[model samples]
Target chain A: MIKRGYWDIDDILADEEPIMVQVTKTIKGAGFLNPESGELDLNEHTRFTIPLWLAENMATRELAKIELPKIFGESYLNILEADPRIISLKDRSNYFFEVATKLNDFLQDGKFITPLQKVFVARFVHLYNEITHNSDPKIIKKLTELERDIYEKGMKTTREFFDWRERKFDIIRSAQHVVNNAKRFKLK
Target chain B: MENEITLPESEFFAENTKITIIPNFKHAGFQILSGFYGPLRPSVAIEVPLWLGVFLKRQQKCRIIPPAWMDLQVLKDKFEEERKKEEFSELDFYYMEVSSLLLAHAKEDIPNHVLICRLIQDLQDLRTSKIRNSLQKITVENLYANFKDIASIELQAIRRLLPATYDSIDYMRKTENND
Candidate 1:
């Protein structure tokens, strides 16, 4: 019943991130999804990269099987387990958490379920501290799109509360959408 | 998910908290939508919502009586209690909004308002640190967080973060049957 990400731009983009899968059943006229393939039909038992959403659908229909991305492998997770605060996970994928979770849903072995949870919690705590005692704005560079969304929300509330305490609420600010609208329709 | 109350909205709700004020001018009472407010008698103390009290205080028609916890002694003790306790000691749910409104308009009514402000800031900082420190105990297995005495404003602070986390975790844990 949950209708998530129907209009979420980040969710849409996360669905577009590439995933590698091996074809079990050859598909005709699907090779254009990967232009480098150049073939008219996708060949069987050969590996190729495709958008995650296509891979998920193909995977569920027994057309292909997902190969774990290098970043989602045991070693990478171990590095995160050692100290999630140290590494910038955004390097692996901007939508690391979202893509990983969606991929996990396809995993029949459920290998990613526990480690993904552990990684998330660890990163979440680190993100929590940084938000409260934030000295650096560049910290967003390290966060995934998901964490960045959470961070922006937390930072907004923190700033609002501080403004309230200092009685510096400048109520004359225009909403971002209004500003964007005016920019779009500005007179020459 | 869209239910988190913003600062202005929370403040508007906090306006409903009752406080005592002594009227210098005569007024029968108010019959506004929320409820009926005091039948004001000159020099006689009457209880009314903070919004009405602040309104009357602004026009110099009434002297606002600072809430019990607004005193220096009470705040100092509260600051100490917050510093010493891991669990949040009880505070008025609308403490932040109420105090800000009072200090902004009715500063002359409160004795040692300066020190009280300082103490409130300290208390807020202590509780904020407490909330942050509790993050260490959170893990995949034990996300059983008890935010018992956290105020609305403070909850508003974490509302976006913790719920998003819970949602992501739920997404990752999605079972085969759910689809």
Candidate 2:
């Protein structure tokens, strides 16, 4: 029953730069081609950029290691630490929070979070706490408005992206179920 | 004081709703707050309530052919003409909602749907950027006054960005006052 707007996060993330990852083990699989660059072949110890969703899948399966770029490096942390203003951070990097969280999720199993991403997340958490728990009513109202914007726009996109992936997986599972049923019947 | 207070208009009108079904389907009549509507048939044009039209359109059961005033050409001309005039022209109250509804639901039915969507989005972006630019120089007294002409949905979109904008502006104002 939820009404989806055109500005959802899946659409936004689709337009964002793909995350770069290095192949730890050779992945000889069909449909692993970089859709944008049309590079189908992936070899061991080779580095390539893929969409965030795909990169997350590969990293989670131990097929690749995520390489956090320099923009998400210590230098970026220095800049954010100096300002610590929400607007300034938003202007500097629109996808920083999204990218950080995605990377954190992908690397959770291995505890592979980068030093800079760690710092940024900690800093953002502090700011978020202050904005939510502020004493001033006017400030609270304004901050709530801002938070609503972020949640509605950004979170919706994230939800839609994951939903599409889930639906795709559902189709695959159903097909596998049918195949398994067919094999069992053949044995009977 | 009466002149200064602009009355908010209702977002949708049920009486004026009409739609064309692209696919075949049947539905039993349903009761709504306004009245009863339905028994919809495929490939046939029917006049239903606005809520029914919207629901059917979202389900891809029908396409709401836009009103004459909501034509892409008409909107484009109006937008261009408004940009040329120093004074802003009064627009339909439901301009934002109607256009967005059509773009979202009846995309296949609308000729050049992509172009129309792009134009509407560009126009909205221009308006939002202008509002943001003005917000940079706004005072608390003039904040509501500045948004008097914007559509309700457009205003809703801008409200999200206002908190951060207001925060920065308020900070600057306080610092200047102190100085």
Candidate 3:
């Protein structure tokens, strides 16, 4: 809980900077506002959209020789036959190969959103490599590069988004706190 | 109208979702969700739709395994735990994962899905964290408010999922710009 008395202020005083937590909060609060349009920011809402991308990456990575005993007992192919998206990708080699190329290009030249989407891509590749370590060393080696880049981009984008949101929400909450305190002061 | 409305089936709990063993047995389907799996066994893996995948991932939280802000060392530990346990048969894992994933992403029933996920995780972790449970309750209430934000017609789905809170209340319809 990092508790201390006022006398311990000397320890923090030598740090030579006002604790920056409040400033970060203010920035995050303001982040919910759009700079160009003066409208409510919508990008902050998109964080919830990551699951589908992660799932897609998982499905494609582990494609072929996949049998779903739950969906259809030993007839996994029959279920995929019913669902189009499962069979859309040709095969594992082609799917991962194409994803690697696409991810490399995006990392090299894509916008902020591209990197954000690739976070799940990296996780997928890593999981596959972990599971198939003994059998598919070659595929794991190839995906390692893609996984590293995608992971880095995902982390950066996630940090920026949260930092921006924190700054915006902090100010909004603080102002409300101030108003309540002021009303109490008047009452006193 | 009472007779006509078809109920949405949870794919996760359906009888159709089954598993089978080959060569040794002719007719065996795995029913892991309703059935039990012993600790340290492999479970089947199910393939799910894209939308569902996104939904389940968000619901996963920090317990023994790391949450979104999990440390590398903790993550490594989780990887080891995953390696050691082999409860979910390949097929059961696929179906369960996919169904849970899809249920997580189903926007109309999101609150319910989120509730189930959090509750289930809590159950698994043997956690009694009030903050976690309260946050879920708050989300469910917010989901109720958001349901009212949409057109009244869409409210029916929300009502079905949240019958106790929503059944008695009537939504205030905002005036459309066209009106």
For lDDT, the strongest prediction is 1
Better of 1 and 2 by lDDT: 1
- Tens-digit lDDT track of model 1 for B1-179: 25777787788899999999999988889998878876889999999989999998999999999999999999888888888887999999988889989999999999999988888878888888888878768998888577899987788788878988887777777742344
Candidate 1 DockQ vs. native: 0.55
lDDT for each candidate structure: 0.83, 0.52, 0.29
Give Cα distance to truth, residue A173, candidate 1, Å. 5.7
Across residues B112-133, which tens digit of lDDT does each residue of candidate 2 receive?
8887777766766566455544
Against the true two-chain complex, what DockQ does each candidate achieve?
0.55, 0.01, 0.01
Scored against the true structure, residue B132 in model 3 reaches a CA lDDT of 20
| Candidate 3 structure, TM-score to reference | 0.16
Cα lDDT tens digits, model 3, A17-117, are 11111111112334343344354532322211112223234235432111111211225334433442223222322222223223223223222222222
Which stretches of model 2 miss by more than 4 angstroms? A1-188, B1-29, B38-45, B58-63, B85-88, B140-145, B160-179
Ranking by DockQ: 1, 2, 3
Best by DockQ: 1
For TM-score, candidate 2 versus 3, the one ahead is 2
> Tens digit of lDDT per residue, candidate 3, span B102-129?
3433334333445545433432232112
Q: TM-scores of all models?
A: 0.90, 0.38, 0.16
- Candidates ranked, most accurate by TM-score first: 1, 2, 3
lDDT-best of 1 and 3: 1
